[model samples]
Target: MPSQTHPIDPVRYGTEPAAPARPIAAAPSAVLSAVDAHAEAAIALLSDLVAINSINPLFPGIDRAAVIGGETRCTDLLGERLAALGAEIHRVAPDPERTNVVAVLKGAGGGRSLILNGHLDTVAPFTPERWISGDPWKPTLKDGRLYGLGSTDMKGGLVSVVLALQAIRAAGVRLKGDVQVHAVVGEETMSHELGTSAVLEAGFTADAAIVVEPSSQPFPLSVAPVSAGNFNLEITVRGRATHAGNRGAAIRPGGEGASAGVNAVEKAILVVQALQTLEEEWGQTKSHPAFPTGFFSLVPGVFHGDAGVPSVGYMADKATVGYLVWYPPGDTADAVKAEIERHVGHAAALDPWLRENPPMFDWKSNWPVADTAEDHPLVRTLVDARAAVLGPIPRGRRETWSLNAVTDASFLEAKGIPTTVFGPGNLRFAHAVDEHIEIQDLVNGAKVLALAILGWCGVAD
Candidate 1:
């Protein structure tokens, strides 16, 4: 927590002077050699971490103790590694079972500070047998990727940071700016309030941050400066219930058709169809520069309709539909909510039952946008670092790039700490049957991060 401290002797950081270093080319990669030297160590640690089942217990529909609740153990393992590197470690556990680790290797003072963040939790492997890697818990190396449950979704990220820090410490480079390595929990479920946000709420932040969230796919490994906002909406439709035999009576011309009763299932179908038309309209109307055409969407992920019981003999009395919506940056979640309610409200007015008893909305999770300007120093330095290390930047990976999905970067941005999403793992395998991250991606990412640190934090002469 203190902002400034005496400059650590450069010799203490490496075997030689911290020499005026700028890793965007110009400076020798005496420090980066550590990454190559310990490449096997990085892979070993990644394999070890992936072996642990750190599935988030809070994940919906999963509460098995045998497979979940590994956050505290994972956090402890990282703490030990950072401690071995001489960094001061602090552990924050919002839930007694799930702990977050913040390892701060304070700078000697002068340059900006930075935080490298990643989550420790993983989504439960629904069926371990379906995993082509043979076992989701035991990492299998095929070609160049290390396949495991958390490898790509991102235990690989943690490995990259450790490698960078280890390389820096081994090179004996005393940074002018502070570096905070944040290994958190609950990211798979957007529980930032208890994870990333909690770390900041505890006053551990920096001038800028890079969430090592997986960003590969439809493009090579890249840096993303922004992410879209999203929300989980559940719409409940109500209707009158009566005996199934009343269906004919309700529909017959000479029967009590007008006042017999209403079928909630039929009414719910109306709502679904109405929203589909709006979703198609959104495809043509809404657009963001970084996102592909029609990327913003309203997905009906879950639908339920039934009476009080599962019996088909009774007419359904109620129905509920759950939707996941993604909106572009510069837009508020409230605006998106209001738009949906308004669209459905207008459509509801068409039906007698819906007009009388409108659908009730219960908005669940809200993940705000993580928006950072492309011209910011953090962005510029990372771009320069990428160019310096990889050369000939990959296509579509320009500074203004965006992430395919939202991440906890939003929490840091919300706290006024500029943040970006950049990492080694490919998004194609994230949360897939055989999740994995390229071993080369990890090494490349570590090199870039090492370079970024040298430039952004500045080298103490």
Candidate 2:
């Protein structure tokens, strides 16, 4: 059922700021009531967003022809819906046909501005047949959860933001500060250059931001004010190749042992072992208040023997190892790199071959850290909204913690805009075969976000 809204008064709702809101003495009952009425509409919008095949084309092994331009269509759809609700829409395409939409809904005036951020891009569904519904794009509602691709990782969060704006409009509520919704592309690749960072670089800014990333710090969602940083590290080791028949000479005490062939894979293994030892050291030393003890870790993701053309009769000359390293927000990428390099360097020194030919490193695609204070106004406001919407919740749900995964929130926080991650859904389902979010959770998220908006932006009296 739609709530009746009186025509907005121009004097109260205008392009310019009016005056700062006085101390909020009463709750905005109308906005909360409107969000409840349109609760189902939030689920419907999530279904629509999930149905779009907006898989990022930049992903490895993705068929560009099948998913290249889907993001543009999403932007178009979001633009139309927001425009109809009196928002000014801006679409950013850092790459061709890959668009990020920023919709700005003006406020009455003199309130803190806010940005609600979400990514429109999703990873391709590699195992679509594995989905219970048999189709990744066909939204299904069963047992109170909406199942579909991007439904959790974050079409649900995006839908919550849309519902918040819709309810505010439907209730004829004009905020004192403007609210901006940034639906971005390329997040699946962490290509912030073409997504979240690009939006800010293009001059779309606010006093604060909320990245509605899936926040299942164990169910019902937690407010995450910090997210660990990560980097893709590739290490290459070199060795001298020789005929397989020289194996005996390579290791024998007197059979040209120093001059014989060296195996790169074995040397790479030493490096990996040394790094594992260093990882244990990190586990003991690197710690943050917002994260679990020993949360920072170095994980080896891929390994390859440098054999461009295989000839089994020969000793391998080179090898490469790929690693994903997660570091605490309190540290810098350069510092972590130096630490690993120092450890590896010391380990390589004792080996005769490695001493002369050291391992090479290539750091790629680093996601920056996000560390907003828990007591910041934006976070405090979100806590207030959460408490009011969900009475007597678990301490973890309202307290700030470090998200185990990184998000575009890093970009916003890096740019000095205080930001936090809070929304509905479990991360285990984000990029999994059967992604979903509960309908009740979705409704509750929308309600909470609506009030948070009013709390932060204030109401013009």
RMSD of each: 7.9, 7.7
Residues 28-94, candidate 2, lDDT per residue (tens digit)? 7777788878877777777888899998898888888878888888777877888889999997877
| Candidate 2 lDDT score relative to the true structure | 0.83
Quality of model 1 by C-alpha lDDT: 0.82
Clashes of each: 3, 1
Total colliding residue pairs, candidate 2: 1
lDDT of 1 by residue, 273-295 (tens): 98898899888877788777788
Model 1, runs deviating above 4 Å:
1-24, 67-69, 251-255, 394-397
- Residue-level lDDT for 261 in candidate 2: 89
